[model samples]
Target: MAADPTHRAIEAVFRIERARLIATLARMTRDVDRAEELAQEALLSALTEWPKSGVPDRPGAWLTAAAKRRLIDGARHQSMLERKHAEIARERDAETDMSAEAIEAARDDPLGDELLGLIFAACHPVVSPEARAALTLRLVGGLTVEEIARAFLSSEAAIAARITRAKKAIAKAGVAFEVPRGAELRARLGSVLEVVYLIFNEGYAATAGPSLVRPPLCAEAQRLARILAGLMPEQPEVVGLLALVEIQASRLAARADVDGRFVPLTEQNRARWDQLLIRRGLNALDRAEALGGTDGAYVLQAALAACHARARSAESTDWARISALYDRLAEVVPSPVVELNRAVAHSMAFGPEAGLRLVDDIANAALLRNYAPLPAARGDFLFRAGRTGEARAEFEAAAALAANERERDFLLARAAACAP
Candidate 1:
């Protein structure tokens, strides 16, 4: 029998072309959100039409041309005032640029950085940081709302609503759909980095999946970081973020066991780390520091990761230096998550009670209430302090809160170890 195109294959097509499709459509339609809608409409057409007609050889080009045809048809059929008609007609002419070669250009980014522009467009400061993260992951990362919801430990409806609001917010603010330059570029780069790292962190430590890491998402974030670094080699912070993710990615093998259970950094086999990635990460960090990014959040964090990558054993790891880096990190990006990490570093450096004090101080904060790491850190400190019963309780709470099955199982195992 001849091979046939499956839905899964078609979806892979969408994932690969997602960023370019939205970028091309947004450029043509002069609207980011509408571009997403039209892209989906084209996908729908494919879903219905391709199974019967067979998959087109150039799926990306086909989707682009299909979406442009829809715009042309809508413009032709809709009634409008003379000026409005002329405007739509002009738009049609512009869309004709989305022919085979144009679609190929959009896909290839032949002469410009369309995807990067789309990244800035989705992450424009007009929307809230939360919205920017959600929208960028959607449009640029090619993630569905459900996947984002699971990563965030939030509801799909909430993510959907935030995406809707973000589009409207971008429209209302009249944020330009192009990459900024000069000082504006620096200011916008922070938001862009945050979105990219959010995607990376989700991949590094997935919240609600059977496995501990999602390689595809992690790879996607790294790819974006590399592209950014290529496009702007002089930017210290961009290089810093790239360094941080690269070093962290090197340890993926040691993050889990043969059965895919969670493995603490202290227990992971150091020999399993990827040397190439470590070299790249260290080189990137050296570049960042050479460019005077010592105080940057990502550079500081990369420094912290370097402490471990250089160590031959867990006991040889510099907990005191890591604690200091966390201390500086807390000042740079103050939050319960940062505080929790700092407390763990403190416990490793100054003993458990010192860290316990800090953890207890933020124990009741609303944001930390359901956050698994807060209790997990507390449990680790309590266990080290010989307060087994209290540690067991915290462990149980963390297990209950954990979203990843592997992480939850690991927590439960720790709780059992503390049984009196």
Candidate 2:
């Protein structure tokens, strides 16, 4: 069945401005769920109106105003609920004479700022990290429960439950809708960065899809990162994440072959890399460093990417420096993924044997049991060390474990290359 054009357009617009729409509604209504409801209502209205009236000159602003009206109507409808009645009465009285111009003006300036504040609020530390990620993706990334589930490789039911629980947790904990100040701001910023990075990473390398890249997610995350950087110029990690994404994204053109086959970093054509994006990435990284603080996870990751970017050729890559940076990153962040990457770096810097040993140590790590890359990395090292049979087996295992079709095909090809 074909998707309705109006529905698809509404989806596209919502994807682009979901964060701002929800942020504005949250500020006005002071309830996250209600704000989302209003935003959804506005989308439905657009689906009805846009096909007939055509898309508005400023679709975002139009949606914002429509959502605002829905909220107002909802508030008025609920005015009979005693305590709610007084709140609505007060808010209505406050905006009794609100003109179209006044409303438009209000939606323009502080509203956008408040929307960003709402993003920070939604990602507050009090929320569990998983919940934070799920909620941010739902509200800000504008992803459906099924889409979010697919991204995480979890069941749709599980994803829905997580989002439901997250919203309930926020309400139960009485989390504010406003942005934090001072130290609280710093802590919340970390959570926000994590959400943004997660979104970008998913886009850059979808865990399970026919397509190797999800460009929309990448563009959305980059947009959010840029907005955050602009809003908080002095925040080093914000700049760091932007830099990291930009640098990594610079290689997008080279990351795949002409037929959309996956191309590993070692095999990518350097000439196809976007120099403009690389330069922007470097400048952002410089800003992050200039802010003068201990490097965050994103900053460290960016530094590692910079090592690759500075190399004119794959052979000139400073594997030792990358290994050292990964070492520092592991000490700070300490994830199995970092350990896996560090092993790869060690192989490049030292020898395949050294990397193989490190991979052996983590072979049984619970976190990496289903992670295809572990076996894939081990296969690469084994192949390099002339252990053809072992490399073939590892690559086959990786192919079985991989979720994305493109990655599976890549691993299978590698496995076939090792066939006697």
Candidate 3:
């Protein structure tokens, strides 16, 4: 069934402008919860009004103005009920002027990056890492709780509770709703970048969904990365993170086929990759290295992506260099996941047997016990080594543990291929 064109247009406008709207209101109200409610009211207003009247030429500004009016009306009602009515009445005119001026300033001034402030607020150190990502997706990415849950492969109720707890943590900590400066900014950046990359990874390979990729979520993450780059041009890690996302996004179009089957990087047609994004990524990588970010975690990962981007064919790729880069990445940010990836790289550069040995070493790591990728990588090595029986069992195990439908299907097909 075809969706209503009008509704689709409205939805697109809301998705693009939602962060800005929430940020602007948050700045004025100094209350994230209240700001979100006002933003929702503005959206409801748009749904009711835009259909009757044509969509406004400046929809963002229109939404902002609508939310502003709601804020004013709420203040007016509160003033009427309070014993301090006289005090509130005296300040009403000044409050109205300030709200308009701030909204306008946010639109014109580069320094008034409200969305960045909102992101910093969501990524406050007080929030748990898992909850930080969930809250950021809700407030900055404008993803619904259900969408966030699917992306994280968690139950909707759990995601909701995490978001609730995160908001309370922020309020309890009395975190200011503004971007930090100097040392404070540096301290907060790591958390912000981690959450942004987490968002991009979910979009790169949806954790649990019918679709293999979620382009809108990927775009949102990239938008946030680009915002960070603009605000901190001198931060090498920031630039490197931007480069990493750009390079990864270039392969998005080729990640799936006409029938929506997952296509491995080595199997994808190189010509289908976005050349513009590849160039952008490579340029950003060069800038990061020039700024003395050669050994940063993000810089190392960008270098690894660059190795693939530079290759005309998978066979021509410098697997030796890639394995070396993975070695550095593991040292910089050790994890069971990195070990699993390093094993794959070792297999590519050396042999299936070499990779299999590495995988076996980490096979008992607690984190990899139920991680589908662990068995999936093992299955690939076994298949390449002509151990069909073992390969099939590993693939089947991976499929059983998989959360995403598309990924499960791909693994099951691999298992079938290992049959006699």
Candidate 4:
């Protein structure tokens, strides 16, 4: 069935401006749930009116204003203080004729502290790390429960519950909606970085989408990381994160062809990579290292990415160095995902057999039961070893498990190539 054009337009606007809307609302309401509710109500308004009114030229601002008015109306119904109501009313009235240019200009302003404050609040240590990731994407990344669940390979119900508890936990702990300081700042920063990286990764390889990558989301996360680096110039992790995102984003241009076909790393036209972004990433990596973050998780990952960025082509890649970096990265942040990456690295550096041993170990783990990458990696190793039949089966399994349509198609093509 065809999706409603108006619905798609509304969803697109929400995706692009969600962070701004939530940040602005959170700043005004200081209550996570209320801010989300206000935004949801505005979204409802868009759904009902946009089809008939013809989508607004400044839809984001239109939605923002609608949400703000709703906030003010709620305050009025509750008989809130006149000073508060008057202040909000004056602010809303000033933008009676909102223009798209005005909306873009206002949102373009340097990562104002309000968005950063909302991020800090989302990363409060009171909630679990899983909850932190979910809440950060929900409140800051503006991802829906279903989107978040697909990204995490969890059920939508679980993700929704986690978001609910996270908001309540933040309120219960009385966590302030401002960036922290000194020890508190250092403690919470890691979680925030983790969440931003997760958002970026999802954009880099969308979990469930027609395209393998979502450039807007990637640009959004990159913008946030760039903003964060500016906010905390001396923080090694922040600099490292900026480096990692910039480096990965450099390849975005080369990931697909003019015909929208997926291009493997070995087949990509290296000349298409963004040199400016690569240089910016390398500079940030240098700064991270200078700040004594050689052992940091993000720094390690950025260094690994640098190895690829430094190579002019796939044949010139320093797989040995990348393998070593992955080994250290595994220790810094032990997870099934890291292990899988290391196995791939080992295969490239050593031999397919050496990598396959590690791959099989990860394949049997219950955690990766539905993970597409596991079978995909195993398929590559089998193909390298000349086991055509086995490789075809693995590739077919990977294609089935893959959530992104592009990725699934790519895998299926590989499976077809293995035929007799």
lDDT of 3 by residue, 189-252 (tens): 8889998898898889888778899887788789889988887788999999999999999999
Worst 10 residues of 1 by lDDT: 77-86
Give the per-residue lDDT digits (tens) of candidate 2, residues 38-128: 8889888888888888887777778887787776677677777766645865786677755545666767664357767778877877777
lDDT of every predicted structure (CA atoms): 0.85, 0.83, 0.88, 0.84
Q: Write the per-residue lDDT of candidate 4 for residues 1-420, one digit (tens) a residue.
A: 129876887788877767768877876777888888888898888888888888888777888877876886776665555676666666666767555566557656464666788889998878887798789877776667887787666799999999999999998888778787899888889878877787788778777766677776677679779878987888999999999999999999899877666788778898999999999999999999999998899999999989989999899999999999999999999888899999999999999998899887777777888899999999999999999899999999999998788888899999999965
- State candidate 2's TM-score: 0.82
User: Could you estimate the TM-score for every candidate?
Assistant: 0.77, 0.82, 0.81, 0.70
Tens-place lDDT per residue, model 1, 1-420, is 124547777777877887888888887777886788889888888878888888887888889888877776666766364565457767766656766667666567653467778888888888888898889878887878998887676799999999999999887877776778889998998999987888788889987768899876688789888877876677889999999999999998899999999999999999999989999999999999999999999999899899999889999989999999999999998988888888999999999998999898888888888899888899999999999999999999999999899999999999999968
- Whole-model lDDT, candidate 3? 0.88
Which runs of model 1 end up more than 4 angstroms from their true locations?
1-18, 33-113, 128-131, 143-162, 360-366
**lDDT leader:** 3
What is every candidate's alpha-carbon RMSD to the true fold?
4.9, 4.1, 4.2, 7.5
**Which scores better on TM-score, 1 or 4?**
1
